[model samples]
Target: MTLQTNDSAPHPNQFALLKQRRFAPFFWTQFSGAANDNLFKFSFTVMVTYQLSVSWLPPALAGLVIGALFILPFLLFSATSGQLTDKFPKTRMIRAVKNLEIAIMLVAAYGFFTTNLTVQIPVLLACVFLMGLHSTLFGPVKFAYLPQVLSDAELTGGNGMVEMGTFVAILLGNIVGGLLVTIPEVGHTAVAIGCVALALIGRWLAQAIPELAATDPQLKINWNPFTETWRNLQLAHGNLVVFRSLLGISWMWFFGAVFLSQFPSFAKEVLHGDEQVATLLLVLFSIGIGTGSLLCEVLSRRHVEIGLVPLGAIGMSVFAVDLYFASRGLPVVPVMGLGAFVAQSAHWRVMADLALLSLFAGLYSVPMYALIQLRSQPTHRARIIAANNILNALFMIGSSVIAGALLSSGFSIPQIFLFTGLANAVVAFYIFLLVPEYLLRFVAWLLSHCVYRFKVTGEQHIPISGPAILACNHVSFVDAVLLMAASPRPIVFLMDHRIFQVPVLGWLFRLAKAIPIAPRAEDPAAYDAAFAAAAKVLQDGDLLGIFPEGGITKDGTLQEFKGGIMKILERAPVPVIPMALTNLWGSYFSRIEQGGAMVRPFRRGMLNRVGLNVGTVVSAAEVQPALLRNRVEELLA
Candidate 1:
């Protein structure tokens, strides 16, 4: 179904989208499918380890074998599956994958019904591989389908809810799966019935999903998986920003796998708790992730705020380190149940650390998922997701190996946790260094929220893509940063050169790619360079923001427009958008009138209300300093 586009209307938030038909069915279908996969995987693993142990397969090898078997299909068939999704309507492909799940679940039911241990265990492993295959085929659709159904404004929250649902599903699946298969006489029957039921439910839900058009309908399908896989990986690595996001996301999976895989051991060795503690930790982490995921929408005000990613990384490291401290120097403690565990304050602190870890993990990861979807080329998006899946599998597998090596070398679980925490700091710094835009955008977002609450209107006037000149009223010292925060696309600001000489802000301005303009009389070279840089930015089809007033408003009134905007527009020939910033003149950054004498700008308020009103775009032929000023003043009014 082609939904009607109402550009003039404010976009509905993530929750509102959940109530709509287009998103609801698909969300439930995907959520159920994930839940079922984990349920079956966990149940089968339990049966293999306890009920059907064999001479050839040790209990320790069971988990490793299962892990490898599950990820193997993603490695082998993800490339092929990605092409299939791109060639067909994603909704239809998803339905087909759900149908495949039903058939596989029937086979699993038969395996469970059969009493032969040898046959049953192999069937279970085969089921794991098939589920992996099921997930691989669905991977690209899982991501690519969202952008089809959601608007850009909804992307971040949509991704957050999807990821949040997934973590919750995994939690329930593990808990329920473990319990279902331990029912003694009815264990096999229960597991069989549950799998078939979940498969049926997921397929029924998939039926209601609206059809989405294939991105590349005429593209030829590659017959060979190996060659196609290589090509798909290449497509994913094409852009530097996209590729670095890929690495960041893959590393998150590695970090998660490391911590999650250690839970059983951490609980047993450190807390002296049994099976219940493991489950408790799992539940706590899931809730934390869900909370953080939901909070992302609120924190970003429905934007994909990448600054949260860095904040999350910092929190993850700090909390992980705190967990080490909270749990260090442990004495012999009784195996406490959930209630007893909470009774001790020390254990509560540990739980707090673990919860914080999970919360930050959600913050760190959910944005990248949305970013990957929004950033990748449309035709190759599914392939890029495939590439991400490949990298995730590799990283997870690598983490397992590293953890095994560390533990085998006589390292405690605390030591491993500390190492992982420290490792995350190094990895985060490296990735942020590679993509400074994520960090810079983060800084702008932080500053905007901390000092002023922005009410932005006519933001749609700023083009989503291509070149444009944004001329705004300069009301305060932080006008550039506020405007940058309001824009979806990064805006290169042309600022007074003196601001570049101020202590730490100068470096930040340079890092933000701001053009430092000087008066022709004072420094002709800097003045010329500023105009040259502004021209280059527009020539390359990038947005450039300039405060046409030339300097900040002195007495809370709009200043006269300068001729520099006209010169910049003459060189670039892009649309000139006029914006107004109002209700900020008396704030900290604006000059103040003292009782007797004029005083400099001083800090005066917290969470002050300010508005950034973007006026309509003016054509270059009619672009004038007076005309732009009039438009800005009208908006400010």
Candidate 2:
């Protein structure tokens, strides 16, 4: 099924989505669910660790056991949940899940009311597992529902708001749970009532979510978790980019999990601060992630800019490594409160590092999520996200194991942070090398955002899916890069073969998989090969970009269209979209009055205003070199 566009907002931003019916109710529903999950789990952990005395579940192992129970459902039920999400109406499933949360919280409230420590311990532990199951079931529906409701233009902002909301909810949940459970006389009762109240609030919000048809209503239910899990992985693996993105996102979870799990010990042992300092670290981290998640829409110009992924990776490594330096060699002192910790200048750097590290983590993750939603097959999108969740659970489990081993082998928490930071650089480099699109987009994003003030008009005209020929008036050497920046999907450009011989840019084009061509008279074989490649691109349902003028404009004016576009159309017969790159003339990459391009740097200085105007598509039957040229000229005008 084709993705639906929400035209509720003429121009949509992250916050603007909060007021829209399509987004707001669902946002609060998921937000309340996350808050309640964290609230219940953190409160239970605190109760067991400090108040309750259980022989089987000791203080040291309380967090570990609770966490294990929480993530266990993802491994056992995520595949089944994904299938169910695709099979049922999303609103129905959302309401059902919220109903389940209410039932589970009621059981938890009874467990909290029990005065017997022995009975209460098992009951709450069971509640932890039940809450994990709640999250597992909701995971697929939460992500899959967005693409069904929001337009491609709103996907980034919507995902940003969701991500920001989720982190903020977690922060609030932890704070509320921690505080409510610490009440002197009625701690348990307050937590019990609070859990039930949040669950009811979530259910109420779920009622307001608009009904959405299932993407794969005819899909048969897969009950066997083991086989279905394998099948789910294979489905995700069908698209290598999507699959690798799943892995990238999982790695991010693993990376962040390590820091989050270490914060308590790191605060107490390394920073010489009390429990309040650990809470302080959590607060800073959550705020940073929320700040970064919100910044994504602004930084990406409201597009699914995966370029930020690499930028985020770099910042994560940098700040993480700096955190080790910031905290190492601190003098041992009596455990200090939050106020004292903040008063010390040395601790300020430590706080900043943690905040910045988590901030970059937010940037690294939101695009990957949006990209997965945008690129995955709508029918199988939920399953692919399920695979991502499974991987995340496994990665988080692996992180715990590895961190435990590292600590047992005498590695300090600061040392572990240093090690993770160094390892992050290697992992990011490897992933980017494997998926060069991330690196390519990073370069294009840098040029468009840093080198120029790039704007796109009529971008909604570009087909979100299917084959189309993008015919543009080529003004400079960097036209393809700017176009790539403007486009949500990758565009395979047909360029002059000689441009392939240009130094650094050549390598970049090759990495981007741009096809090169020569004049038939000069090199018939190369010309034929280029057109063959272009046809294959369209045949595979990808965008093929062509500069109808054949090369860059020499005098910064429109040139007569060439017959190359006609040649490609004759083979693929896809719709041709005329585009115009404006205000790139006289820029550093364009041919100047003196002649050669790129000979002088910063000719137009920084943030030079440039734009790509995408005109409406012309049918294959009506496509002609002259017709396409006139369309581009009109756009240029």
Candidate 3:
């Protein structure tokens, strides 16, 4: 069954989603659940670390144990939850998950009410595991549900809002949990009441979510988690890009989990601050994530721009390294309150580093999540996300263990931050090398948005998925790069062989896997090979781009279309989208009056306006050289 998008409003603001029933109820429901989870967990961790004493559970290990328990269910039950999510209506699953959260919180409230440390600790620990189970069940449903309801255009913005909301919810939960647990007399009671109240609120919000049919209603159940987990990993591995993205996201969790799990001890020992300082760090990190999440929609111009991924990685590493330097040599001071910590000039850099690092983390993650949802098959999308959750859990658990070992080895918290930061650079570089598409897109995005102002009209003509031919007028050498920036999905361009000989741009085209075509009369083998490669791209259900005019025009005028597009259409009967590039004639990449392109740099200056106008799709039968040229000319006019 085909899943349709629920994007009724044209050019709607991301915030407007909060007002619609299709999105709002689900958003708030998940928000409340995140808040409750952190509220209960942080409150318990703070109580154990600062308020209570236990030999079996030391203060140093409190955060790690709590975090490990919460993610444990993701490793064990995520596969089953994902299968169930696919087989059943999402609204039903959401309500059921919310109900489970309510029950778990009630149990936790009872535990919090107990006065005995031994009884209270064990009961609360059990609740943490149960809460993890709740999140595991909801994980697939939360992510998979978005692609069902949002259009491709809205996917990035929608995911951004959710990322921002989740972190903000985390921020509030941590703040409240940290503060309430430190209260003089009613601290425990306050935390208990808050957890139950948030759970109730989440349940109430879940009731308002509209009914959504299951993506794969007939999928058979898989009872064994180990077998199902392996099967789900196989499903994700089927798409290398998606599978790598799953690993990338999991790695991010690994990096973040270390810092998050160390916050209590870092605040107490390193910064010499009270519990409020720990809460303040969370608040800064959460606000940064929220800001960065919102910035993604603005930065990408409301597109699923994966180009931002590399940029985000760079910032995350840079800020993380700076954080190490910022906090490395702080003066030894007495434990301070939030105000005193903020007032200290020496501590400001540390705070900035945390916020900025988390901000970039937000930018790095939202696009990947949107990409996974957009690329994965609709039928088993939940399972793929479940695989992601499983990987995330494993990586986070590894993070806890490694961090614990590092601490045991006498490495200070600042040194761990430095190690993680440097490690991030190596991991990100390796991933980019494995997938050059990311770097290529980054370069294209940089040129399109920075070197030139690019805009696209009738972008809907570009298919979000499946095979199609993009026939555009080749105006300048950078035309393909601009098109890449405009497209949500990758396009395989069949360009003249000479363009592949150009300086830096040649390397970029090669990296983008563009097919280099030659004239059939001059080099038959190369021409045949290029055509064959183009055919394979379309055969594999990917977009094929062609410059039917064969080469860049000498003058600022349209050239006669060549017959290459016709041959491609004959090989693969896909729709040909007519497009035109306007106002790129006098640009730096275009030919000058002397008939040489790229003779002068910045001829048109920065932010020069360039536009791509997409005409209606022409069926394979109706696609001809002259017809396509006429269509392009019409769009150009």
Highest-lDDT candidate: 2
By lDDT, highest first, what's the ranking? 2, 3, 1
**For candidate 1, lDDT tens digit of each residue in 1-637?**
0112115557888788789888889888988998999889888888878887588778878888998999999889988888888889998999999999999999999999998877887887899999999999999999999988887778888988898898999898898899999997998899899999999999999999997899988889996888988888788778888889989999989988998999988998898887888899999899989888877888886766787899889998999888888888877777778777777777888999999999999998988888888888888799899889888989999999999999999988988889999999999999998888788777877877876788888766767667888899887667787887887777899999877876666787788889999899999998989999999999988889998878776667788998998788778788888888888777766665542112333355577788889888787889989988899889988
lDDT of 3 at 448: 81
**Pairs with steric clashes in candidate 3:** none
User: How do these models rank on TM-score, best leading?
Assistant: 2, 3, 1
Reference-based lDDT, residue 282, model 1: 94
Q: List, residue by residue over 295-383, the lDDT tens digit for candidate 3.
A: 88888878789888898889989998998899887889889999999999999999999999999998889989998998899999999
Candidate 2 pairs with clashing backbones: none
Model 1 clash count equals 0
* TM per prediction: 0.95, 0.97, 0.95
* C-alpha RMSD between model 1 and the true structure: 2.9
TM-score of 1: 0.95
TM-score of model number 2: 0.97
Displacement of residue 70 (Cα, Å) in model 2 is 0.6
User: Poorest 10 consecutive residues of model 2 by lDDT?
Assistant: 1-10
* Better-scoring candidate (lDDT), 2 or 3: 2
Of 1 and 2, the candidate ahead on lDDT is 2
Model 2: CA > 4 A from native:
1-9
